[model samples]
Target: MKKSIEEIQKEIISEFSDLTDWEEKFQYLIELGEELPAYPEEKRTESYLVPGCQSRVWVCPSLENGELQFYADSDTALTKGLIAILIRVFSGHSPKEIANASLEFIDAIGLSKFLSISRRNGLSSMVNMLQNFAKNSGSEI
Candidate 1:
């Protein structure tokens, strides 16, 4: 069976547990960003750009078999990794799953406290966008 969102969050928290230093955590985030699939150039447009971010970020969602799949990219590596984390948690899940998720892992992983105010805002924006996509399931976002 596929992992639940909470399971994924636990895994992420576990992954971050070993990296006690902020520098290490930031490096890990960059590495996570490196793992993201290359985003399509054509989809890099104003409509897909996520607002409230210090760096330019774009997230595209598609509904397939009732699951929401997300593709994203960001101008900065850190932001890219942030999006990657969100994608990992939200993608490949039903709209209701993504919409109802509490995403407490962010706080558990200490990411919320470590991020700058702007970065935190950006992260919040990304979460809002993902939930918005879920809320507007099957409709164009």
Candidate 2:
């Protein structure tokens, strides 16, 4: 009964469609980050730290039955929102599905263009981090 990854991406795209400018979209993204659940201080260990990002990001990825459960937080609001967006697509899906996800929706929504070069690199790093977790769990992306 759950939505597929494409469905989620399309929904996100639709949400962005209502905003006419990048500034508005950026604000919306910040709102999303603000709504993210509080991360426990205990889980902010080095093991959860994501490297290569200007802003510190901590992600705790686990599997429930066969689906991925991604718990993430970031020191920067924008980065937190970026992680939230990825979580919406990858969480609750099987590792193989996550591995195979296109994620071209990022471009479709013009997300990367609005970000700075370093942020884009950080975003890519976050994606790689998640995909690496999927691969480590035995999914072939």
Candidate 3:
């Protein structure tokens, strides 16, 4: 069975808990970014661009077997890492699950505190976009 969003978040929090410093955490994020699947050039158009982000970010959502799968990428390494984290938690879940997700891991891991105000806003934008896609999809869980 697929893990719930909260379950996945807890696992991520546990993973971050091991890192002693922000530098180490940042390195971890870069490694996570490196794990993101290769994004298609065709999907990297204006339509997929996430608004309000400091860096260029694109996310494409597809519904398969009653779940929403997200494909995302960003121009900056840090931003790419951030998006990768979001995708790991949100993808392969029902729209209802995603729409209702609290995403407490962001705070629990001290990610928001480390990011710049602009980057924080960008993160917020990314979360909003994900939820909006879920809300708009009208798919049953």
- In terms of TM-score, which candidate is strongest? 3
Candidate 2, position 129, lDDT? 94
lDDT of 1 by residue, 50-129 (tens): 98888999999999998999999999999999999999999999998898899999999888899999999999999999
Check candidate 3 and list the clashing pairs: none
TM-score of 1: 0.96
Q: Which tens-of-lDDT digit does each residue in 14-119 have in candidate 2?
A: 9999999988988888888887788889999998999999999999888888988899999988899998898888999998988878897799889878899999
lDDT of 3 at 128: 99
Model 3 lDDT at residue 89: 99
- Off-target runs (Cα >4 Å) in candidate 1 are 139-141
lDDT of 3: 0.94
Candidates in order: C-alpha RMSD to true structure: 2.0, 1.4, 1.0
lDDT of 1 at 69: 96
Residues 51-130 of candidate 3 have per-residue lDDT tens digits of 99989999999988889999999999999999999999999999999998999999999988998999999999999999
lDDT score for residue 1 of model 3: 86
Worst 10 residues of 3 by lDDT: 132-141
- How do all the candidates rank in terms of TM-score, highest first? 3, 1, 2
